[model samples]
Target: MSNGDEEGVLRVLVVITRGERGGAQVHVRDLLVGLQGRAALHLAVGEEGFLADEARTIGVPVHPIPALQREVAPRRDAAATRALLALARRIRPHLVHTHSTKAGLLGRLVARRLHLPAIHTAHSWSFSDGISWRRKAFAIPLEAAAGRWTDRFIAVSAADREVGLRYRVADDARVVVVHNGVADTSLRARPDRPGVPVLVMVARLAAPKDPLLLLQALEQVRAPCRLRLVGDGPDRGAVEDAVARLGIEDRVELLGTRRDIDAILADAQVGVLVSRQEGFPLVVLEAMRAGLPVVASDVGGVSEAVEHERTGLLVPRGDGEALRAALERLSADPGLRAAMGRAGRSAYEARFTVQRMVEGTAEVYADVARRHGLPALRRPQTPGRP
Candidate 1:
């Protein structure tokens, strides 16, 4: 590797297909932030994604690969793979780590061909229910084949680890579970409330997120409540249309793309997430850290993050009636909300901080390097090598 004289000062190249404003994207960026000053970091990202802008702002050297899109075009895939291989040849990185599906496949294929150690972290498995069976069947063999090229497999949740085992990507020894973490941003405490129940939902306005169902549940709530939707996406207009159709537009406010999320949570009574599935959402942790009572759908990694009645309430996914009941129960009982919020914050402090995540990932990097025959970490010895 071109990084140094094999003294464990590794060079790492992070390749991602699309770094959009999503949970996985945020987690990868934060991982990079933690690795700063520890390794020589380089990025190869989609030419036009939110991540490129964010990565640039963070002062990482990013190469724009335009063909690395989320779509499945054979020509584009080949081109992006070629670009990645060429960059790997030039960068001579000791370690290549890729996040998300598209990048994981193409980047590892290239990294292995170039005789480099590689790690792939699946924020969530791409092939799951709701997607077509044809896609799932195809993904199985593709991921298994890709697994041969990967050295360490990182799953963001235990459920995802099960999926990896089923797909034959991880047998046991090769797999490690790394929970996602967020920056220790100081969240302003929720201000004293005096009016109607305020419910805050933060998610991309996508179909999977099912923001419309939230509106439906809001309509069913017997108590008066105001809904705040934070995030912008292609589905924004549809969500707005749903609000208008329900004639609850006045009670619902769409606040798109605000960096002042802590302040938003500060003003709300309860924080909610209703995604069809999740891979350990950072927003849930943020809400918990902000000390807002949570009412989220019971899906994927959400149950792992929320403690049901103790830290939050989890209703059956897609059940508007149960969702309405949970919201109303928490809304009517301030004591219950306060108690759950306190527990959630305590959970945040115990498990999910930037420091803990950095240490875990750094240890993983050291392990991967040692397995690949890289030199052990050097101490400023009273002479030199052992």
Candidate 2:
């Protein structure tokens, strides 16, 4: 399992369940880009989608494990485990890092079998409070078992770390909080638009994310505002039906997955996310980066990024009235929106930049290497060497 490099550069094999355009996938893509010159990187994904494509385009070798999927299929799981084991043996990376649940489970198992150090970043735990009880029942013990094999657990937020601690997934010493970050977007000064204020929510239309609730709230909104739902998922059809059912079709637009999120946010007045569960969503960070005030559900670590009454407002989950009130309040006050948007941008610059996240993660990798008596991981002395 030698790295085969005289320079002692750290070689890390990064794995994730899906290659879709989700928060976790985006995080992985950004990480690979940030760590380009700092380490030798390899990516293994369940399917060929946005992440795999982006990783390949960035010159990272992409390994496909056809059997690695989100659903729980014993046969597929075993096959995926075998495929990953083979890949790990062939690559012989210094360490294995995994994201998302399916990859986290099988990747660690493969790492343990190969006697390699394993690090897992829990984007969101299956056993979180808002998750289904059946899932929690199955996931709790399973994660605890996996935690034993994991050398380090990267929780995207302090709240996520607390969940792992409460469930005994891992001890506090083994888990670290590294908030998700996004590259800063150049802010475009918004010109005054008079007719209707636009609210944008960039999230997959899926469970945990309640686009329908947002639609219902839209129906009751007193302020003249239009809603733009970006990113598509399994629940798109249902969301469309709900939009029509609420008779707010004119007020809602479904812009399924676009690369120009920054442009869209630049034109928008506010950013919103109403989710049942989250582990510090990158969308909120993007919103902050784009200099837009957020109005998100008060769940998971959202409160960590969005300060109540400062950067934006936090409403109770699934409370349509509260959501409407928050929306209306912000819609009516142009001065307040401008002030909050400024605060959000300041917060983003101070706390959630890609450089900070990449360095924090590299530190974790260094810590793992040091404890294992492996060669030290070093960053290139020159900035932007890649």
Candidate 3:
């Protein structure tokens, strides 16, 4: 009988900066869930939201690093690094895998110090997310340094990989592209809502997400359609105000944060994402799984997920006219919407299932194990044997 220490069962320590409800957090959670039994999982994250609590729900050991924060705080970041070093010494992980930029920096640093194998996953490049020039200058150099400290990097989309290379954040030889995947939890294909077409945007109300572009496009969309903005963030007030100014108050529904994602998808005819930067968004995958045509800005990893004119329409990012035309086109054509939805569902089933994602990630772990010469399970040593 094989136990956790059995042959090929690697012990991995997964780290992320914050438990805030976001894409990177979701990536870590789903990856961990899929890796269960295949690896002995230990999760380290900041005390933020449902990430730690939900991981605990699934019986994964949770370590909350109080000093680890989303935003930069030199003192706290230093403390967080120290805490990670101590945790590494105690738990003694075979390999450290980090998600999100902050944790990626800290985790790789500690692993390098311990002379252990490690890799970082780029959910999105921090510097590419529309930060100030001063911050970008500082972040790009720091990112390069972190890349040097690690063994390999997993990019969830080709767009993400491109950003890293364009900025010289990571070397070409050390990066691999692995598209994000979601479980097939689709409900029945929704009949288009009565009165007006419902276009759903599943993203935080932040600058990178750019909900305002969607609002501006909606204002110009000739077809009478309702935009359902799901999720909230620091830019809610701006988006809300824009909604009023665009005279879309009645046509736009601000669903702050939602748990009924399936129901929401089931009611919508199309999905939209106007993020200025993204790394293979999961919402688009969810929309595909739910059999809805998507109309998203051609930004980041979105093109790789949405096949142009087949599964959805891709418009130029931040181009209000282009985005408006795409949305209105879908609103006016039910047959086009259904055809694209069907194609998207087929694509999702073919390439974006959780099982496929788990397998791809496990392969990465195996390669890391092989390179690091991970210890294999040996039969229990005879008592008193030297």
TM-score of each: 0.92, 0.96, 0.92
- Candidates ranked by TM-score: 2, 3, 1
**Predicted candidate 3 versus true structure: per-residue lDDT over 72-160, tens digit per residue:** 89999999999999998987888999998889989999999998888899788887745568878888888998888878899999888
Which digits, one per residue and each the tens of the lDDT, describe model 1 over residues 236-301? 999999999988987899999876887888788899999787767888878888887799988777
Model 1: lowest-lDDT 10 consecutive positions: 377-386
lDDT of 2 at 197: 82
1-386 in candidate 2: lDDT tens per residue? 12344256778999998988889998998888887757778899999989999988878889999999999999999999999998888877889999978899999999988899999999989898799889899998888888999999999999999999998999989999999988875665241246578999999888899988889888998888889999999999999899888899899999999988889999998899999999999999988888888999999999999999999999988898999999988888878888889899899999999878888898999899999887776654443311
The order of the candidates by lDDT, greatest first, is 2, 3, 1
Candidate 3, 254: how far from true, in Å?
A: 0.9
Candidate 3: regions farther than 4 A off:
1-8, 129-133, 191-195, 375-386
* Residue 292, candidate 1: alpha-carbon lDDT: 78
The residue pairs that clash in candidate 1, if any, are none
Error of 1 at 74 (Å): 0.7
Model 3 RMSD in Å is 5.5
What would you estimate as the lDDT of candidate 3?
0.83
**Regions of candidate 1 where Cα sits further than 4 Å from its true position:** 1-8, 375-386
